[model samples]
Target: MGSIDSYIFRTTLTSFAVVMASLTGVIWITQALRGIDLMTSQGQTILTFLGLTGLAVPVLILVIAPIALMIAVAHTLNRLATDSEIIVMNAAGLSPLRLFRPFVYATLVVSAIVILIGAYIAPDGLRRIARWDSEITADVLANVLQPGRFAQLEQNLTIRVRERQPGGLLVGVFIDDRRDPNDRVSIIADHGTVLKNSEGSFLVLEDGHLERFQAGQQEPALVAFSRYAFDMSKFSRARDVAYGIREHYLWELMWPDPNDPLLKQLPTQFRSEMHDRLLAPIYPFFFAAVTFAFLGLARTTRQSRNFSMIGAVLCAFVVRLAGFALSVIANQTPYVAGLQYLLLVIAIAVSVWLIRRNVVIEPPARLVDALNALTASLSRLVRRPMPA
Candidate 1:
């Protein structure tokens, strides 16, 4: 690459990084918000919450990396035109193909990153999330206690704690049990701790008083205790956890176990996931190609290029949407995977033709003049005011 191509390449790569990071962060926050309950109600620490939510970032990047590249391409090209840099290059005898070389390099780099993220990084994250969720669900001690909040296990059982200390002492513990309609029991303690043993987990209340209320007796019976223990096994018992096909490894998706019950069953969905990942890396290049095709040439026109930009955006949108549709169809028929590659080839071909022509895309001259006249008439009508 020459000096100009090198400069453009650096600029495009930087823009892509910035855009991809910004997009990933924005989307990740929205997705991660769903896990906020882990910290608020599930007794999970901040670190645990972050770790669980952070697992989704790689997948988010896989989905948005291509879109970021296209935006970066459009932005770099537009900035070049706005600063007349492209015009200067053209005057220096730089052909359209030569000028577009930088974007091609940047797109390839981004595509490689997409391949890594889609094939390995993202699936690994999904697997981690599955394992983490399973652990949290099985850790009964952490699952049942929420500091400074009243947790209602059911309509009759209510538990509240004023706060919890670092050493595992729960302060101001209150438990109201009304499961037996005839006899109600309420327990209040100055402190409590959760203990796990060979048998099961137990919530042990210390320095507490237990009160019993018998219905229709109109009098409450109260007794004090040094220590009281309640079984917590129901809250923390481990159960079977199921993972989605997305959590599976690439090889698992490719050569799924025949005896594995799921692979033997809904094979179509597994095939669809595999094809989508394999084809993701091919999209950034074509998306960049389509965007560059519209504004590949540097024209001296003072008119707005908004229409041309919109046209390019719509064209790319249509192509990508078609690819998504094909992926969906492939779930039913694996043979349709070929159509995705065919679409990419056709898009690249047409884009190459557009770049070769090196002409500015716009509406007909007559249409532009007519639109200008119409705008003038509308301006006059608004300025004239109602008849006096």
Candidate 2:
């Protein structure tokens, strides 16, 4: 590569990295906030909370890479134009296609990243998260029982612990069971530990007393025992991990097992996900073409570049939104999936044709005039004096 090509490639990739990290961090923080219950309610440590939340980063990158590439391309092109470098290159007989070569290289790199994450890493992260969530649900004693908080294990059943010590020791354990209408039972234990075996989960209480208040009788029965087992198997959730279509690997989606239950139930969803993953890498190329078509030309300072930038961004937005809408519609109408590919093809083809022919894209004159008039009216309203 030549010096100019190297410079453009490096600048665009650097910009892409910065934009990608910034956007991912902001979005990931919002997503992580939703899972704060893992720490606050479940009594998990901060490290565990972050580890579970960080698993979502690969998925976020899959969505953000194409947009970042477009932004980086636009920034590099605008910078070159602002410095009159594009004009100088054009004067030196550099064609639009030659100038776009560096952007294509950068886009390819971003596309590879998207492909890698979408195919394997993102799906694996989702699967791991699902498995971890299932484990947490099945281990009800550790997750649901919080120190000093009365945890409602089920309707009409409550349990509380005064304190939870290290190595899963519970102090001052109390349980109230009103599940049976005929007899209300309450048990107070000095201390207990959760025991899970092949049979089921049991709370082995030591030095506890059980009181049974019969509904028909006036006197209640009290019994004290040195050791008692409270069956807690019902509180544990199902351990079977049911992964969704988005959690499956790319190859699994491409050729799904005919006997798979999820596939048998939602065939269209499998098809939609397969197409979405297949098309993930191509978006960066389409975005780069669209951005270059609008802002790649060498324009003088007298001409407004802001409109071109806006047009490029709007076009990218429309294309991505259309693709997403098509993918969703494909879940119901299988035939709609093909439109995603067609949209990308048409958009990229048109963009490349414009670039080759040096056709500068601009908003319609009427729209620009209307916006200017609206701005003037708003300015006048703001500047008008208040009536006393």
Residue-level lDDT tens digits of model 2 in 1-388: 9999999999999999999999999999999999998876676678878988999999999899998998999999989998999999999999998999999999999999998899999999999999988877777777888889899988989999998776668889999999999989999999999898998889999998999999999988999989999999887756888889989999999989999899999999899999999999999999999999999987788778888888888899999999999988999999999999999999999999999998877778898899999999999999999999
Q: Give the least accurate 10-residue stretch of model 2, judged by summed lDDT.
A: 39-48
lDDT of 1 by residue, 1-388 (tens): 8888899999999999999999988998898899898876667788999999998898888879889998899899889999998889989999898888889999989998988887788889998888888889877556665777678877888888888777678899999999899999999999999898999888899999999999888889999999999777777777676668888777788888888777878898888888888888988988888888887688875857787788888998999999999998998998898899899899988898888888667878898899899999999999997978
lDDT per prediction? 0.86, 0.91
Instruction: Give per-residue lDDT, candidate 2, residue 335.
Output: 95
Best by TM-score: 2
Off by over 4 Å in 2: 146-158, 162-169, 176-186, 191-238, 364-388
lDDT of 2: 0.91
Winning model by lDDT? 2
Candidate 1: clashing pairs of residues: none
Give the Cα error of residue 39 in candidate 2, in Å. 1.1
